[model samples]
Structures are given as C-alpha cells and as structure tokens.
Target: MTRLRSAAAALALSAAAVLPIAAPAHAESRAEAQVNAFFGQYRDAVLGQNPNQDPTDVREEFMTSELNTELDQWAADHDADPVFRAQNVPSGWSVAYGGSGAGHSTVILTEYWAGGGHTDVWYQVRLDTLRIDGLEDAPQ
Candidate 1:
C-alpha cells in the first residue's frame, strides 16, 4: 500500500510540472497570432491600394515611434528607400519571449523580395502597444 501511494504521488508531481510547460506554448501561440494580425494590417495599408506602388512612400503611423524613426533614419542615411514587400509563403514565423513583459515578444519573419531573394526580418513586438518597437536584420 505504501509503494502504491509513493508511485501515485510521483505521478502527480510529474503531471504538475508538465502542466506549466503546456501553458507557455499556448501563450506563445497567442503572441504569434498578434504578430500575424499586425502584418495583415500592414499588408492592407501598404499593398491593398496599389500592388506595384513603392511601400516606402506609405506613411507608417502603424509602427511604434522608435521603429518608425529607425527605419526612416536608415532610408535617409543610405539615400535609399526601405520597403517590406509581402510574399505568399508558408508560415515561417517564430516567436521568442523578450523577458521584458508578458506581451513582449521577438518575432522572426521570412520576407521575400521582388528579385526572389529572401531575408528574415526581426522585430521586437510589444503586444501591449500592438506595435513593434525595434527592427533589425536577422543574422544569417
């Protein structure tokens, strides 16, 4: 009887430990969903009107102030327009928790260019603000 109780207790403890791990997976899915929704809004705002238009000319009020400033500075410094061209590809988004807050996540997006080149875009998405605060070129 004692051995049976010990085995049951061990099983209960293991089950409790596994339950927390499952919760984070659900949280991560929610974060990825938020990123996808933001991208959908961006696609509508930039590409819905004119598919061939230069996206750099579109106003970026949808972005976080810091991200917008950094992108604008990059364009001004390089004397070239920076645009995020949309591509129809399979889901390749990956999200990591940023450790700052519950809604802070780092999202990796694989975006394709007009010339068939592909690049991964990294963004620090703060779901609280529903915007990306930082954007950087993903390392190869």
Candidate 2:
C-alpha cells in the first residue's frame, strides 16, 4: 500500500511538471506582430518597385528608407549604382526573414543581387529590444 501511494504521488508530480511544458509562456505579442509587419512592408516595397532607374539600365538598386540610409548612401558613393538587370529576375530584394528568439521577434535580411551574384546582409534584429530611434541590433 505504501509503495502504491509513493508511485502515484510520483506520477502526479511528473504529470504536473509535464503540463506546464506543453504550453508556452503566452502567445506571441502584438509588438512581435507589429515588428514582423514592418519587416514585411519593407520587403514588399523593395521587391515591388523597379530596382533600376530605367528598364534598359543593365543594373540598378535602391533602398531608400531612413532606417538604412547609410548603405544607400554608400552605394551611391561607389561606382556601383544600385542596379541589376535581367529579363525576369528581380534586380534586388530586401529579403527579410522573421522568427521569434530571445522572447522577441527577430529579423535577418539581405540586399541581394538576383541570381545570387552578390549580397549585403544585415544581422538579426529583435523586437522589443529596439532603441528609441527604432533600430534593433541584429542578433548573432
């Protein structure tokens, strides 16, 4: 009888422990959703527009958001105009991939040249961990 009680008690304890693990702390928050939405909007803006100034221009690219003006200015400074030309390929895409990590919505993206020729990558950025200026560090 004593053995039976002990076994049942252990089983109950184990079951209690297991149940909490089944559920996460909570659902993803509104902040996470908002951050992901922002990333999606930026990505769409990049992909939807023509990267080249002229259709005939062999190569061109542009990323005009204040969020990342440094890189845009850098491209302009160099001989390489932000342009890529191909029949059907996107000249450049602000490819943003979002995931939840460290209790935050994180993003990693690249300014990619079509056909995988070249890319300028950004590290992961976490939501709820941004500065006052709305910039988040890219997670390693």
Candidate 3:
C-alpha cells in the first residue's frame, strides 16, 4: 500500500509540474478568443451546420462595413471566398494575438486545409470596439 501511494504521488507531482507549462498553450487572449469564436460560427454557417445563419451575415456581425465591402470586391476579384481566401473551407484553424498599436490589434489566423497545406490570414481589429476592421493575406 505504501509503495502504491508513493507511485501515485509521483504521478501527481509530474502532472502538477506539467500543468503550468501546458496551460498557456491553451490560453486564448481576448482578441484571439473573439476571432476564434467568429471563425467557429462562420465556419458553421458556411458548412450549413447552422441552417438559420448565413455566412455573409456572420461576417457583417464581426467585421467593419468597409472591410465587408472590401471582402466582397476581393472575392469577385479572386473568384474565391474572401474570408477563407480560398475556394474551399479549411478543416481546422487557430487564432493568435499578433500585436497591438495605434488603437488597433492584429490577429493571426492559420487555417488548415483538407489533405495538406495551410494559409495565414492577418486581421486588423479595432482595440476599442474589438471589431475586425481589416483582413488580408499574411505579409511577405
């Protein structure tokens, strides 16, 4: 019984040691969380998981009017979905806080495609309103 208790304690200690290091990896900043939530809903809409919701409506809710207009033009120009920046929806995605300055914050969204490959979309968010104001391909 004593040996079992010692082994259990060792396991517990190991878990405890890993908890702090693992926690931050899962931690989402405010900007990241917002972007993540938006993407999740947008993806659902695009996939028709939410029958009542439209993907364009989702974009309007999260993005600035000017950005929405720009996205529309971009979609026409590229002949692809402007938000995904691709013709197909991604299989997975992640959002991260890039940086903030001049009353705006940057959010980096990496989209994982089916089969293989990924795309990074950079979003500019207004700090005060937290509204996404710009979306563009990752800078060269």
Candidate 4:
C-alpha cells in the first residue's frame, strides 16, 4: 500500500508540472510591439529572409521612426535630393532588445547591409506618457 501511494503521488506531481497556466500579457502595446511591426513592414516591402535574402539590393529603408527622423534631418542638412539619398543611404535591419526597465531599454540590431556590422541601440521610454524619449545606437 505504501509503494502504491508513493507511485500515485509521483504521477500526480508530474501531471501538475505539465499543466498550463494563464498569464497576463506584457509588451503588447509597448516597445516590443513597435519592434514587431517594424519587421513585419520590412518583410512586406522586401522579400525578407526568403528566396531573396537581404533585399536591400533593390532599395534601402529603415523600419524605426528614430532612425528615419535622424536620416531625414541629415538629408536636409546636406541638401540631398530624396532619390539620390534613398539609393545611397543605409537600410534593411533586424533588432534584438537586450533589457527593458521602467524608462530605459536596449536593442541590438544587425547592420550588415546598413554599411557596417552590428550595433546596440539604446532607448528611453516615458511610460507615463507612453512615448519614446529617444533612441540611438550609441548611449545618450
């Protein structure tokens, strides 16, 4: 009887371990969503990571707002025409976020086709305002 009880208890414990549990969502409407949307748009614009891997050969573009804004300012400063700028500027990227806290986050991205290797992007988000204070490759 003792051995039978021990076996039954073990089985019960194992079953509990495999049982699924409900959990709340995180990053659904935050930085994480932003990252996902960026990549999804990228895949749509170019046949990304498919038969035509790294499709920047056709055109260049950035999926992040921060980078886009910076590029626009640079173009304005240089008096660069839009068509010429698009053909020469860096584009096509993938990102991996490091850690996120109350107001700060880190994202590492592949910068191969963008003219170099990989880069780590840092971000400051104001949760209260639900807005990104800033984002850049180097520390701000």
Winning candidate number (TM-score): 3
lDDT of 4 by residue, 39-98 (tens): 454454443444543433222333335545664675587675221233343355555666
Number of clashes recorded per candidate = 0, 9, 0, 0
User: Which wins on TM-score, candidate 1 or candidate 2?
Assistant: 1
Tell how far residue 72 is off in model 3, in angstroms. 0.2
Runs with alpha carbons beyond 4 Å of true place in candidate 1: 1-28, 48-61, 79-103
lDDT of 1: 0.58
| Candidate 2 segments whose C-alpha is farther than 4 A from its true place | 1-4, 14-33, 49-71, 77-140
Residue pairs of candidate 4 with colliding backbone atoms: none
User: Best to worst by TM-score, what's the order?
Assistant: 3, 1, 4, 2
Q: Rank the candidates by lDDT, best first.
A: 3, 1, 4, 2
Give the total clashing residue pairs for model 4. 0
RMSD of each: 7.3, 9.7, 4.4, 8.7
* Cα-based lDDT for every prediction: 0.58, 0.42, 0.91, 0.49
Best by lDDT: 3
- Model 3 weakest lDDT span, ten residues long: 20-29
Q: Give the TM-score of candidate 1.
A: 0.51
Clashing pairs in 2: 59-83, 59-84, 60-82, 60-83, 60-84, 61-82, 61-83, 124-138, 124-139
Predicted candidate 1 versus true structure: per-residue lDDT over 56-95, tens digit per residue: 4233544666667787787677664333423343223334
Q: How far is candidate 2 from the true structure (C-alpha RMSD, Å)?
A: 9.7
C-alpha RMSD of candidate 4: 8.7
